[model samples]
Target: TKRYYHERVLDHYNNPRNIGSFDKKAIDVGTATVGAPACGDVMKIQIKVKDNIVVDVCFKTFGCGSAIASSSLATEWVKGKTLDECLEIKNTDIAKHLSLPPVKMHCSMLAEQAIKRAIYDYKVKHEKLNNSETTTIETIASL
Candidate 1:
């Protein structure tokens, strides 16, 4: 069945932002890959952290337009946010921002999962790389 999509979602789908991947192995980079098995949607969200802030974020999504738009907007919202601030990002917010319907809300949830996972991954890397230098975020999805 067809469903309605918000204009902002269409805009994002048409002109996705930060649509790329980063080197996952980079000390300052955290990569999280998530997927929705039911829909065959896969999303990877990667982030670069400096001083516990998300300086940059990138994403690659292999899914429907909603998933792509959700991820694209997620990247835009996460950039320039502190790790804690990023943590505050919610799927509901993404849904509201894009005006997504209940059925499509999972796409936003995917984005949220990707963001948190990436942050956690970054924290792990940060702990390890504390003694090392810093650098740069990819496909991320959620169920």
Candidate 2:
């Protein structure tokens, strides 16, 4: 049986939006790369967060149409959402949005994982920054 892709999927693949990387060194930026080479799918997602909200996002995917579409859709959905809201974006939702087949379901899963990984990185960096600031303040008070 031949399968057809959803229009949204085809649109995303044909003209993928936010298909590039950002400056990783930026304080507000977070990036994550995830994939299995054996599966022939690699996806990298980057996010810029402000005040606990995702203000921007981008992705680069090296894979099939499904993988590209999934990542593209993920980036679009995550922008303008809070970190917690972004976490709520599930693989199932992505699959449904793209009308992905069971075989391509893993592509959506990869997108979700990428988002989570980026957010985790952002939180870790901010935590370290906060801790450093606190230590500096304590040191100043003791002087």
Candidate 3:
């Protein structure tokens, strides 16, 4: 029988740091949405970037203790990392940190995917702004 790691998760869940809302105008990337009902979890992860590095991150999670812990850990992992490094944070990493049971593994997956989606949303918007400017310049040059 496996010993419960509830305390591990609780520690993070109860003392989650970097928990707060961010200003959309200052954030390099922002994403918020509900996850699948079948999974019984939802998370919103936002990262603020400066010079291609994540200067801050925050998350609001609803689900099992493991899910909350994963979100808490993910927030810690992403902050102060480059976007590329943040993208590398995996579900397994969170699970390992919390010593989560196999059955609860999906919770970490939800957290991981949610973080990636937020980053993806931010990257898409960043690219669009850059592309728009490039297009405008090209058009003017062709005139």
Candidate number of the best TM-score: 1
Model 1 per-residue lDDT tens digits across residues 1-143? 56577789989999999988888899999999899877989999999988888898899999988899999999999999898788789999999999888889888999999988888788776564432222322233213
- lDDT digits (tens) for residues 13-105 of candidate 3: 789867776765554756644464667688777888778888778888877778888888888888888877876888998898888989988
Best-first order by lDDT: 2, 1, 3
lDDT of 3 at 82: 84
Taking every candidate in turn, the Cα RMSD to the unseen true structure, in Å, is 6.0, 8.7, 8.3
* Candidate 2 residue-wise lDDT at 105: 90
Query: Which sequence of candidate numbers ranks them by TM-score, best first?
Result: 1, 2, 3
Between prediction 1 and prediction 3, the one with superior lDDT is 1
- Model 1: lDDT of residue 121: 88
Question: Positional deviation of 63 in candidate 3, in angstroms?
Answer: 1.3
Task: Output the number of the lDDT-best candidate.
Answer: 2
Q: Against the unseen true structure, what C-alpha lDDT does each candidate score? A: 0.85, 0.86, 0.74
Is 2 or 3 the stronger prediction by lDDT?
2
For candidate 1, the lDDT comes to 0.85
TM-score of each candidate? 0.86, 0.85, 0.79
